[model samples]
Target: MRQLLQRLNNNSLYVIISLLIFGKGLGFCLNRKFFFYPPQFAWLMNNVFLDYSMMIAGIGLLVYVCLPSNNNFVLGVLLAIITVLLAIITCIEIEHVIFAGEIEFVQNAISNSAIIGFILWTARHYSKR
Candidate 1:
């Protein structure tokens, strides 16, 4: 039963990550029309090439970690990178809020925080098993 729960948890994590990748891809393709945040946040979404690169990097790391003969050290490094990226993104949103004096992107900031929380939780959960 313990092993079965672990397997289910791992599969669900992958599904969540896969959905994030798909959503990022769709937003990249749609540009400003994606409308997750606002027009101000549109710049981040509009850069399709950069978005694609970041998304690919993340997914590639996940794939490498999930391979049959994967190295645990590499997986740990990937998780660290993911955590740092989430932190950087959250910081950027905070910086924007500080400089622009606009509360419009508050929702974006909160959403980034949630993503960071999710990533951190997943990292901790997987590290335990």
Candidate 2:
């Protein structure tokens, strides 16, 4: 049991980061048909730009985690930042869902939860290290 827990802690970062990226891909997959984007975002100005910008930031954090030169401290900080950013985004999306009746908040909340879990897991792992 102890060894299994240790293994899980060591791999937590990779698991959470993969979930984050997978969430993004799932969004695109659900809203796309035959390689074409759904019309859902066509009415919003700069929607694609905003979406891609968020994706870039998420990918950049994943890249940082994957780099060999980083230690647990740096990785933990990055994870915290990503978690906070995702929390804020999740709140914004929640507000939109409440006021504007948008339906995409569920996925955003799931992503945010994963990010928050990652931060918590990182803290525990760092302490154990």
Candidate 3:
């Protein structure tokens, strides 16, 4: 059990993923009554943008954990690229989702965010050294 736990903590991708997910989940739990989104930002934080952000964050988590040991640069590059993609996609999709009145994106976003949370937790269980 100790050995298994040690292996998980050494994974950086897992740590990032966990934090991102925790961040997203925090948002949802804080605004449970608002099933869709806040009225003040109806033009922003649309379902599409939210989903896209979650996806990008998810991708970041994947690349962080998937890169080879000698490919730290590659892993970092991938994470950066995916994060940018997520941000860009979210910005563009926000207006569209708002106009269309579709809010299903939150569902996908939350699901993916939860996945990141678990991966992050597992990663943190391993050895840091």
**Highest lDDT, which number?**
1
Stretches off by above 4 angstroms in model 1 are: 1-9, 25-50, 127-129
Which residue runs does candidate 2 get wrong by more than 4 Å?
A: 1-12, 22-50, 101-111, 126-129
Q: Candidate 1 residues 5-113, lDDT tens each? A: 5544655674465456446555645664533345576676356665565476567655554454446676667656655655665676676677666566678789867
Assess each prediction's global lDDT (C-alpha) against the native: 0.60, 0.55, 0.49
For model 2, how does the per-residue alpha-carbon lDDT over 22-88 read when each residue is reduced to its tens digit?
4664464355432112335344422454445445556665555444454766666656655665565
On residues 1-129, what C-alpha lDDT tens digit does candidate 3 reach at each position? 564444445565455653564465446435544433346665454444554455556555554454434454554454554455444445434533566565665555455545534544543453323
TM-score per model over all chains: 0.62, 0.50, 0.34
Window of ten residues with lowest summed lDDT in model 1 = 28-37
The better-scoring model by lDDT among 1 and 2 is 1
Error of 1 at 28 (Å): 4.8
**Between candidates 2 and 3, which one is better according to lDDT?**
2
lDDT of 3: 0.49
Q: How badly does each model clash, as a count of residue pairs?
A: 0, 0, 8
- lDDT for model 2: 0.55
RMSD of 3: 10.0
